[model samples]
Target chain A: MAYLELNNVHKTYIEGEEEILSNINLSIEEGEFVAIVGFTGSGKTTLVNLINGLLEPTRGEVLFKGEPVKGTSHERGVIFQNYSLLPWLTVEQNVLMAVKEAFPKKSKKELTEMVAEYVEMVSLSHAINKRPKELSGGMRQRVAVARALAMKPEMIIMDEPLGALDALTRGNLQDEILNIWGKDKRTALLITNDVDEGIYMADRIIPLRPGPRATLGPEFKIDIERPRDKTEMNDNENYKQTRNAIIEYLMDIGNERKSEAQEELVLPDLAPKDFVNQFK
Target chain B: MKQSVSLNTAGKIARFNIFRFLFQGSIAKVKQMDPKVALKKVAISIASILLFLGLWHMGAKALYNKEADFKINKALEERGQAAADSEAACIASGNPDCQPNTLPSPAQVWASFNSLLKDHGIISADKAAFKEKTAALNAQREAENLDPIVYTGRPSFVDQIWRSLGTVFAGFLLAFFIAVPLGIFIGLSPNLKSAFNWFIQVFKPVSPVVWYLLVFMIVKTVLIGSPDDSSFTISFVSVGLCSMWATLVNTAMGVSSVDNDYINVAKVLKLGTFQKIFKVILPSSLPLIFTGLKITLSVGWMVLIAIELLAQSPGLGTFVWEEFQNGANDSNAKIIVAMFVIGIIGFLLDRIMLAIQNSVSFVKTDAI
Candidate 1:
């Protein structure tokens, strides 16, 4: 059995009168890095939330390690796009808070050591004592990463965590995350709108089609080596082929949705009238 | 000896180099300093004070001159005639009749001040006499087995000042005690917020005077069951209720305004309610909370004085009232001085609170 399984997951958000997600199904194995790629408002966040037990699926089951997922727990740590580190707490404190909660019985010394280790892992030991406001966007996200990793969850879910960061900072954090994920190969899932980011970071990239009811479209296996360099991967033939394939698929979905919208707007009775009476 | 001499020579050279470096650095720093900015600040301050004093002197001269064009001169003349009449009455009755309605000139008020300070020791003597009278009164009541009226001895300017300050502080403290915790609870819970919000909105708009009257009557009829309640408890309660509304509203808003991201962080970390409130919510909301408190305290002072005036409580407001009623000419000058004193004290209090707020503000993380 897959380590994490979703059985015909369905999420419906009532916006005036519209159902959001019909039936979404996916299976992720332990030590597998999976990225969900979708356009904006493709129910990507809802899917990630369901996977992390932040939001329950309306008509489906999310099984984590053979048990159905319930409400939020420290067992699955999530890194949000906003880098939700407590502004009042120093970076070290933010990390330590999670560590302490995850392992309540651990000694202060042990928790302190764990916090330090993670801070070092993120290469933010220098900024550990700084509050979120004092740090730059990248540093804050690094702190958030440190905080999530400190918990040592069974799986780490990221919801476009680097979307707010600049390109240079995003690339740096991506490598740092990849390095961290490389160590223990823990179950990881990333929800991203960036197609290249998904291909480069995840073992499998799943494209989500947008709609009044959105669902998984196609899974693309990223047949690339581990610790892949961005430049090197871009030059690789397989990488280029996969990137083009995903983009082509997404563009096709976009075009289909656009034409569907046009069809909906079309009024058959409003077509051009015959001008036979004009000559008379 | 030769080695020691060589070492001394090296030390002297090092010291000379250090002195030269220090002198050069000082000269550079001084040269770079903005003397123009300093001079401008000084010039502005001097100009402001000069303008203030100029206005005051002109107003004083106009009042004294009694010119037909100056409307205040007519008022001053009327005041002087009233003072003369009161003085004649006092001489006839062998009692001082200085009061607000019959304001004396600065010269007359200054003379009276000197006489009171040097000859009769009126301020201090009156205070002592009043204290003694209260003590005697309390003793008599104790002996007679009557309800003891706490006679706050005869009021001096200082005594009145202290009494007013005491009431203001006591009322402010009471208000803070009630409002801060309640505000926090309301801020944190949406249900409580909704429940109590209407009540707060209703009460908040009601004026302090209304609160004072309501509380005064309640205390008079309900709590003490007597019109002669001497504890000033009613005054304090009235001030507290009136001032507490602002603090409560502001604090709740402040707490609610705390960044939602902090709350999310707390949730993800699984921090307990207590930890989250104390560590995150309280610190973030502190600037606003302190600002609210500062405003509440100043308003409390104003409300306390008004309450004292209405309640006939022994404070500065009552003193002002009694001086007004006594019909003494010099009393107006005293009132003016008291007004200035109140303003200065209020300004200082705000500055003090601001300093405390800045001290407790969130520490910059980069300082680490």
Candidate 2:
């Protein structure tokens, strides 16, 4: 059985109203790294939020380890977009807070060492004492990455964690995350709009359609060899094919949205007065 | 220490120099200040203050008679046209009748402050002597197992200032404790927030004097059978009630507007309700809460004098009122001294709050 399963999950924010997501199904096996690629406005965040148990699916089950996911748990560490960090706390302190909460039985010295290790892993040891406001956007995101990894969760969820960084910083962080995940082989779900990021980092790529009744599209399994290098991937024929396929799929969804936009705002012909007259 | 900061504007560079000067002694601060710019700002600030004092001295000296106003009025009254008319004419001519009555000159106020210090020293010495005389009687009472009597002598100027400080702090602390938990509760639940909104709005605009009266009445009634109903209790409670709204409103606003990402992070961590609030909600909301607390403390200090006066409490307010009523030669100058003291203390109190706010806030909050 898969480690996490989404059984035909559907979510509508309002009662008896617009459905944001419908028939979203997925099966993530243990130690698998899966990335969901989609166009903008694909409700990509909402899908992972459901899987992380930050939001509940309206009509389907999000099962974690064979049980329906209820709410957020330390078992799934989430590295959110926009770097949700406590601005008052330093980078080391930010990771230490999560570490302390996750492993209450660990001594203070052990937790401190663990926090230092993760901060070092993200190459942010120089900025370990700086608060979030003092750090750059890319540096703050690195601290967020360190904070999540230090928790030692069974699964890790990344919601476009690299979305806010510059190109150079983004590439460096991608390699760092890949190296860490390669060692542990933890169950991971990454949500991104970047096709290359999905192909390089994730084992399997799933595409989601644009929302207001969005659903998952076909999955692309990357049969490329492990421990991939960014420069090396460009030379590999399989990586090229996989990246092209994902981008092609996203473009198709983008065209679908353009047509859907035209059809979206057609108000019903029946007005309130007409409905009242019919009632009378 | 050798970090370079290039600036586009001279004004911004000057401001940065000032900031660097303020933080010069801190160990890890890397700001390199231009000494010329720092000196220029300091010189300008001191020059303006000196200019203000010069203007004040000139205005008061010109407006007030150096001497002999009483003699001029008396001579006019002796002519018996009308005493009131003579008094008015004498005042217009800058006679010495208005010496003690006119707006006090800066020098006179400064002299009065010094005199008040002398008076405090004398009063303290007298009180000590009185305590010494009563020591034997008090000891006898203690030996007999009766409660020893405390010295109920008149407090001096320094004592009054000290007492006022104590009372204001007590009031601010009361407001803080009462408002913070209530604010958190209201902030967490929308229904409670709406329910509290009415009470907060209604009571917030009520005058400090009215609050003082309400507190005095309630405290008096409650402590009718006990020794706890001092005017001190009444004044502090009134001050607390008057200033508590700022904290309550700010705390609720802070809690409700906590960032969405932090809330999501808390949920993803599977934090329990208590942990979520303390870990995510409180730290995120601290900036606003501290903003509220600073305002509340200042407001409490502002209203404390009025409360003390109305309650007839022994603080700076009472001292000012007593000196005003004394109608002595230096009474007006003494009142002016008290005014400056109050203003200086209020500024210091605000600076203290600003320091605390900066430390607690995630960002280095500018002293607004």
Question: Which runs in model 2 stand beyond 4 Å of their true positions?
Answer: A123-127, A259-280, B1-32, B61-100, B147-150, B227-229
Q: Would you list the clashing residue pairs of candidate 2?
A: B69-B95, B69-B96, B69-B97, B70-B97
Residue pairs in clash, model 1? B98-B328, B99-B327, B99-B328, B102-B329, B104-B329, B130-B153, B130-B154
Residue range A1-280, candidate 2, lDDT tens digits: 8899999899998889888999999999999999998777779889988988889999989999999998888898999988999876788878988898899999999999999999999898898898888889888888888888888889999999998888898888898888999888998999998888888889999998888899999999998888877888898989888888888888877877788788878877876888789877
Docking class of 2: medium
Q: What is the C-alpha lDDT of each candidate?
A: 0.80, 0.85
> How good is the docking of model 1, by CAPRI class?
acceptable
Distance (Å) between predicted and true CA of B221, model 1? Answer: 5.0
**Model 1 RMSD in angstroms:** 10.5
Model 1: residues with Cα > 4 Å off, grouped in runs: A13-16, A260-280, B1-35, B63-153, B221-231, B363-368
| Candidate 1 per-residue lDDT over residues B1-368, each given as its tens digit | 99999999999999986555434533454467798966776799899978876677667766544432243334447777676555445444634442223334455555655643453356576656776878878798899999776434455666677888888888888999999999999988899999999999999878878998788677776765455565488788888889888789888988888887676667667778898888789988887788689888888887766788887878878877777777565666666656666777777566555555555676411110
Best by lDDT: 2
Q: State how far residue B5 of model 2 sits from its true place (Å).
A: 47
How large a fraction of the reference contact set does each model reproduce? 0.50, 0.81
